[model samples]
Target: MSSAMTNERLARLYDRIEIQELLYRYARGVDRKDWDAVRAVYHPDAFDDHGNYKGDIDGFIASLQQRHAHIEQSMHVIANCIIEFDTPDSALVESYFITYQRVLPSAGDARANYFLREPLADDEAVQGQAIGRYADRVTRRDGVWRIEKRAVIYEVYRGMPTIPGGRLRDNWTISSRDGRDPLELLRIELGLGEAR
Candidate 1:
């Protein structure tokens, strides 16, 4: 192959990796409640439809903040991602996710009722699991790839009462919404400088 062809192939590979990272960032941002990180994943004029809500990116973020505030913690695991390039500057991406959320009973009487069949004990919480997919229109603008529009489809979900004492205790180092993740220790081990 010609050098130009090899370089083009390499560039496409890099684009694919960058797109995957953007998806990972989106999941981390949502789980960590880092609104800024969420914002960075999308274009300024992005649109989102997440089943329960549909609107512009700002409205989407606001709605998430309101809803997630009631939850103690969340984790979104991406199981599969497929990207189809439409052009050098645009792609269609689908990402499958399994999400787990732990919400306190105080979210609201109505919302709590959906999760708890009976009243939750003071020491217990509600755990929810969801299987879903995010279908996104991604575009490259100014040399950066970001989501231009997205639609979330939930395949199934269930909630159950969590057993008492099923949480970490006395762990000083934990993940944070402000970008502090215990996994950063890996950087130190690898002789890299301070982790951001």
Candidate 2:
């Protein structure tokens, strides 16, 4: 191939990688409750249709915060990211995700008192899983790719009583929701702190 064509192919590959990183960032932001990172994944005027909620980007973030507030822990895992370029400046993308959440037990709920060894009821504190796909319209603006619009399609949802003694023990290292993960210390030690 000619040098020009090779360069064009390389650029396209870079764009694809960047878009994938953007999707990963979105998942990390959601799991970590880093609203600023979530907001950065989209364009300033992006639109989102998340099944339970539909609105502009700001409204979407607000809704997420409200919904997540009642959860003890949450994680969003993204996979199968595919990007198809429609033009030099626009592309369509889809990412598959599985979201897991442990909801806080309601007040006076037997499950809330961990000391009790009674069997859990069907309606007790629960763990939930949502399998979904995110279809997005992405555009390149000022050489940066960001989501212009996104719609989530949930394929399945499951909720079950939390398993007895399922909680993690103190031995496990903890990750933080405020971007202060222990990995950050490693990053600083390895000269990766400047990259972020």
Candidate 3:
């Protein structure tokens, strides 16, 4: 293959990796409540249509913060990403996502801790999962790729039943929702910025 063709192919591969990284970063940022990281995934002028939220990045972030304020913990899994280049500097991306959240009755509630001996009742807490797809229009501007516009489509939502566990879960290392999470600490120690 010609050098130009090889370079083009490599560039496409790099763009693809970067786009996928954005999806994962979004998941990590939201789950960890790293708002800065979440903000980094979008362009300044971007618009988001996230069901209940349909506006600019700032509003979207505020909505997320408010919606998650009562949650004890959350986890988001992103998968099945499809990226299609519409132009040399623009692409359409779709990614399937599933999020599980441990909802507390109220912020700073003592019962938020896992009580292995007892089954969590619906009134005490709300354990649920949301399945959705993110359809995004991503563009490369000044050699950096970021989402220009995005639409979040909801597919399904269901509750996660509490399952009793033994001492293994008791000894598991805890991950915080803020910067104090174990992974965040390690990343910070490694000089990987304020948040990952």
The numbered model that scores best in TM-score is: 3
Per-prediction TM-score to the true structure, in the order listed: 0.84, 0.83, 0.86
Shift of residue 110 alpha carbon in model 2, Å? 17
Q: lDDT by residue for model 2 over 68-185, one digit each (tens)?
A: 6656667889999889999999999989999887765552253333324355564456677889999999999999999999999989887667742247787998765555767655
Q: How many residue pairs clash in each candidate?
A: 0, 0, 0
lDDT of 3 by residue, 1-196 (tens): 9999999999899999999998899889999998888999999999999887899999999988987787667899999999999999999999999988776656334333323324555456656778999999999999989999999999987764342221136578987886799988888889985754
> Where is model 1 poorest over a 10-residue stretch in terms of lDDT?
175-184
- Model 2: residues with Cα > 4 Å off, grouped in runs: 106-123, 163-166, 178-180, 184-196
Model 3: lowest-lDDT 10 consecutive positions: 159-168
Error of 2 at 162 (Å): 1.2
- TM-score, model 1 to reference: 0.84
**Ranking of all candidate structures by their TM-score, best first:** 3, 1, 2
